[model samples]
Target: MMSRVAGLFRPKEAPVVEQEILSEKTAADKEANVISHSQNDNSSPSADKSPDTKWETEEILSDVQAGIQDVEALAKVWTRWSLIVAYITIWFIYFVDAMQQGMSTTLTPYVTSAFKSHSLTAATSIFSNLIGGLFKLPLAKVLDIWGRPQGFTAMMVCLTIGLAMMAACNNVETYAAGQVFYWVGYNGISYTISVFIADTSALKNRALMLAFAASPYIITVWISGPLADAFYHGPGFRWGFGSFAIITPAICTPLLALFYFNYRKARQMGLIPERKSDRTFLQSLKHYVIEFDAVGLLLITGGLALFLLPFSLYAQQPLGWKSPMLIAFFVVGGLLIMAFAGYEKFVAPKTFIPYELLMDRTVLGACVLAGVLFVSFYIWDSYFSSFLQVVNGLDITKSSYIMNIYSLGSCFWSIIVGVLIRTTGRFKWLALYFGVPVTILGVGLMAHFRQPDVNIGYIVMCQIFIAVAGGTLVICEQMAVMAATTHQYIAVVLAIESMFSNVGGAIGSTVAAAIWNGVFPKKLADHLPVELQGNVTSIVASLETQLSYPLGSATRVAIQKAYGDAQRIMIIASTVIQVLSIISVVAWRDIKVKDFKQVKGLVV
Candidate 1:
């Protein structure tokens, strides 16, 4: 009692927080124990006959569980002041990174136009998104094996390299190349920070923590437009990109140093154990090659590239879909995808995929939900900025405000949704009945208001509506997936789950391109008078030509009609696919974050 009284007088770590972390570790161990027992009882005949089978998933899982335990144990050593400093640094990093994103995204069109390759926007988006998604799986393994600090460093390297490439690019191809590295880096950094937050926060409180991490969006939405405008007017887009290449690294260096220092301290204190392998150097290289499932990733990447790229390019080619090259791409891509599935299931000794988690209803459902939502959103959204500027006669600054208001709504409301989840400890009804419906309503509204001569206020309301739903879905679905898995595989789960969004976005972009290139030119010719029909090629190629004719003039009016006619087809398609989110939510087994026993694929 006297010692307790002294403890009360002294500055102490929050006991509730400490207790929660300790409890989470215990729960993770218990979940693993149950899985181990199940595997032991229901052993395969091949495994029972040969106990040395390398395919035993339990070994990999046990190692991951051990790492999580070590991380939890290490957290106890973090001084209260250090944790505060680290979190504040994280917040600051996100703030600056967000501003950088806002600057670059707002400037992308102008940069492309500067190179006279504005028409290649879809190709660039599809390629970068694919690179970003493909890297996450390998990067997840890197973080799981080496440490978060190392992963953060790799992320910074990619970011800097890509930014520098973009800043110095002399052609569209070089800019696209830079986009590959920068996108992967941007995604890697975002994922690493979130995983770091997950490493420290308790499961019950993680939603709120993650939601707060995204709070920079709320502020950046307002600032990014004006800032991008300033750079456009003052320094030009290249200088804007060039300055961030220098600035991002300078700001990120301090945080990177802090991460390494803490990681080293953890190692020296015996909180993290060094990995040991008996294989020789060459053998170890082979082991990692297998561990990373490099072959599987290559197959999938090849397949997706061959399969998906055709969607965007087929329309641009002379022969359209009938071209031999396009046919071969479709056939080879399909074959490669099929080969990937077979290899993962029957060939890879150690797959990166958490097959067990994928089997879980909640995980599969949430992933499908996210993928489908992106498919719908990107279909309409991929060309929206162009539409606003070309058809509605809006400037870049004003268009940014209208477009990014979604960010403001989603960011602000995510905090509210996070609080709701934490308070109630359930997400199914909120996700299914509320979030899905609101999202559909928003998408449906877009289908109506996106036409020519529609009031802009109606479109803004759609943004507000979708923004709130987006905030709701972001927190709700993430919680649903988290509650389904144990601590060990959270990073893997998140990375793979996010890959679905990328896949969906890629598909959406491809389809949007197909519609724009396939139908828009013909529609433009139809809308224009016979005398003006000769200008179709020029109008399609140049945003300036499209917008040069003042609003209400025959040319501008015809352009608006063509824009509405094409985008309406895209909007209707988006709305149709959104209903899939409901089905994804339905597939989730109701699990509560507050329930420790039900945390790992256990239904309440």
Candidate 2:
């Protein structure tokens, strides 16, 4: 209670008020005070209204007012530089973060191959992100109490060590352990950085800062493939992951030191308040952890694991859907989720995620739309390479180039959509108006794809269209989700969405991969001779060696025919996924713009 009273006197932390504007408001207040003082003096003139006393008070007031103006001028200078400094700092940190994520993709195929694993080992990537997402909530609370710079710096240190450990690993256990460390650190730091940007930036520049921060994600996704290839194929893959450990510290350390100095400087200037609270760390833990709904977290996590595990293990040689272990995983996971909703309704204080949010039209709609968009992205990213390989007859490097095209499309659209949303507040209609048709057209076109030679130009166009539509939905969802809730909950909401996206990607990849691999082989057999039908993998290996031959001639017609049929089947599955995404958008509620205001007990 005393802490709450202290906040009433604490100065607001933000961009300093302009000196001229400050002077005008102060002078107006002084004029009123002077008039009141004069009236009081007249009422009690006999008490003594000496000239010297009046002059002394006036001089003191003048000194204080001039001192305030000087302080204001200095504050303005710091504010401008702080924005620039922060942008550069976040940019550098985020660059390496994205680079690491991108580098992982290149490492996965090699890592699995080295270990002699039959599966794609993409689940390692999912598990890494899963660990990261799980840590985001705890990290969010930590940032609120410890301050952003300190929180960010601590997480970065873990990240650096984690990367170093992974680079030195020679076995799968050590490698997985190293991955856990890297992910835990990466998720915490990235999440805290996001909150810091939201807290420190102004309304005008918030979207721009967010867009710049997110740039590294797609940029690295595009660049990491070639960069990793260059390093891994030449020096070693270990060196590839190790490169991040060295480079990241160089990028992060200077920014962290600068942020610390600036934060201190701001606090002293009365731009940021010294937020001391009565509650102990133990109290905070109890309040957030013990008070939160554990059942909900368990249910959601279980549901996601059940839905994703099948895909993670699908492509393995000894795949089995009817095994006792698989049945146990699904049955128990399903029951736990069903019980989660019942717990939510009966539990007191509820979970960290309120049931109310699930019912909120805008918030719920955004989640559904996000799931669809995520599914599309999963299929595009996971299957596009296979498509290029089978239909376009491209090698790993060439197929990667085609996949990078989507990242380029995403990058350009992210910035464009950010600017558009900020300029036009009609974000709801912007999504529904644009999302519905482009999604339908793009997914519909993908369903009908055939051999690259038939119309390669058209295929690329359709992919780009889907990319734009998906990008638009991503930006709109960010706005809607943030706008729908209090700023204090924004970090939690984003983390939830991030978790869902991970789940969606896992499910989409599994389902799409299953469809393509399951149906395409049968289709391939229909046109090819019975002897050649069963040897699909060998046929593709043979086709690669025969790339110079006329793609349309009878000599390679069988291969082309097989590839075309497979491509069509995958596209058909994608269309069905896209339609489900559209249906999910129907539940989304429109959210309104809100200003940043302090919420008691929740300083974030």
Residue-level lDDT of model 2, residues 1-604, one tens digit each, is: 2332222221233222210111234576444221111111122212244322222222111232222222222233243444456566677688787777666654654564466431334445455545455555545545544555666777888888878887888865567667767877776777777666654443323455566677766666656777767876788778877988888878888777766675566456454434456889998766665443444666766665665556545434354675666667678767876777677667646464544655667777777776666666665455455456556766555656556655566656767776776566446776777866787687678656646566666777876887777667776776666666544456666666665565566566556556544554455556666665555554433323334346565435665666566556656666676776556566665433322221111011
Q: Residue 51 error for model 2, in Å?
A: 35
lDDT of 1: 0.75
- Superposed by TM-score, candidate 1 places the C-alpha of residue 491 at a distance from the truth, in angstroms, of 0.8
**What pairs collide in candidate 1?**
none
586 in model 2: Cα distance from truth in Å? Answer: 5.3
Give the alpha-carbon lDDT of every model.
Answer: 0.75, 0.57
Local accuracy of candidate 1 as per-residue lDDT tens digits, 1-604: 2232122211332122222222334576655422222112122223233211211221122445444544554454555445555666777778888888877777776776766555566667787788788788888888877767778889988998988998899987898889888988888988888887776665666777777778888888878888888988997777777888888888788777776676677678655667677899999899789978999989988888789887777755789899999999999999999999999999989775777877788889998988887788788887787788876678888888888888889888988887787778788888888889999999898878988888888989999999999988878777777777666677788887778877787788788877777777789889998899898877776665776788888888888998899888988888999978988999998876665421221000
Best by lDDT: 1
Which structure among the candidates has the greatest TM-score?
A: 1
Query: Candidate 2 — worst ten consecutive residues by lDDT sum?
Result: 14-23
Over 4 Å off, model 1: 1-13, 17-62, 65-70, 274-279, 597-604
